[model samples]
Target: MDKQGANMTTNTRIYLRASTDQQNASRAEASLLEFANLHKLNVVHTFIENESGASLERPELFKLIAASKQGDILLCESTDRLTRLSNEAWDTLKQSINEKGIRLVMLDLPTSHINLSNAGDDVTTAIMKAINSMIIDIMAAMARKDYMQRRERAAQGMAKARAEGKLTGRKVNTVTNDKVIKLLKAGTHSWSEIVDLCGVSRAQVAKLAKVVKAEA
Candidate 1:
């Protein structure tokens, strides 16, 4: 009845990500790796990155997809770890995953674990796929909703603070910002390289670069 026997090696790629560089991207790595070992899944690669879940510009995530083939599991700690993208972006991501025939497995989504093994009958597998897809889609939608809600709440808080004369806006970290500006002024490194070096956004570097050029 079970197609994937004891000796069947499942190629699983574990992805760990965080929204910002300050957060440890590998925070979930140990647990996910332990899960893989417990499940006997063969982990062929591990991709980690410090990137926002709001955007689909994560290089490591796309790289993992490119490296995977049909039946290969794209494993992550949770649905939110995979995405907190808006509906359109999430649809795009889902399209890519489906088109590539990659299996999505989340540690929190037990339903998706069914796809990890080839042990079920066709009917059972079909049922599991339907259930898993439905559950994951719901989770993705909720994640997106949560992200939007948090952003809305932040905006509201900012507005309230402004009205109360309590908001001075974000204070520029002169130490970091000046360092980034100096790097840009040096004209020696690329924006991305500067971003990595200074732990600041590309837009921040570009803004500082424009100011420096204007002052010159």
Candidate 2:
């Protein structure tokens, strides 16, 4: 930590998220740890989850907020990692964070980096906070826009495929499917547990379970 911020006691909660189970939420864990170490920030906990950024249904995120107290730092790799939520959902999330007096810190946002160090005087702090908040809002909006555009493109592609009579559902990952079948046959793991272990959705597990039962 910088000597200027050494006098302050800053507790940080690191949050890591991946849009899908196939992606490794902890991919940035080492970098985040280095960042906390470099800033001498006390990391109270690290929450990792595989969930869509566009949704407010992330259990781990809410748990993180619940665990945090006033003046605590909620650190992440980027604003997009924290949210690609719709405007209304984003507002709700922002309200929750603000109400808890938690500081939002993203590694990609330079303006937010000041949060890791001493914020100087009250006026400076206020100004910095305002600027940081505005920038974060802008970034969050951009992230949402990008997410929307991607979804639109995907929809258009699917439509085009259907028009061409070439539309088919996504190909099954046979290896993963086979694994799911084996686990279902073993009958030891719960559906939720299998989803976590196989990195497949609960619906997929259920479908596989049906297939296993039919074969039996």
Candidate topping lDDT: 2
TM-score of each: 0.75, 0.74
Best by TM-score: 1
Candidate 1 C-alpha RMSD relative to the actual structure:
8.5
Q: Lowest-lDDT window of 10 residues in candidate 2?
A: 1-10
Error of 2 at 91 (Å): 0.9
lDDT (10s digit) by residue, model 2, range 136-211? 9999999999988987998799779878979678876989999998888777899998899999999999888755
What tens-digit string does per-residue lDDT give for candidate 1 at 1-216?
113345655578899988765679899999999998998888888999987787787899999888877778899999999988888998999998888888898998889888787665688789879889999989998888887888799879977987898968677788999998777767789999999999988899878875554320
lDDT of 1: 0.83
TM-score of model 1 relative to the true fold? 0.75
Clashes of 1: 0
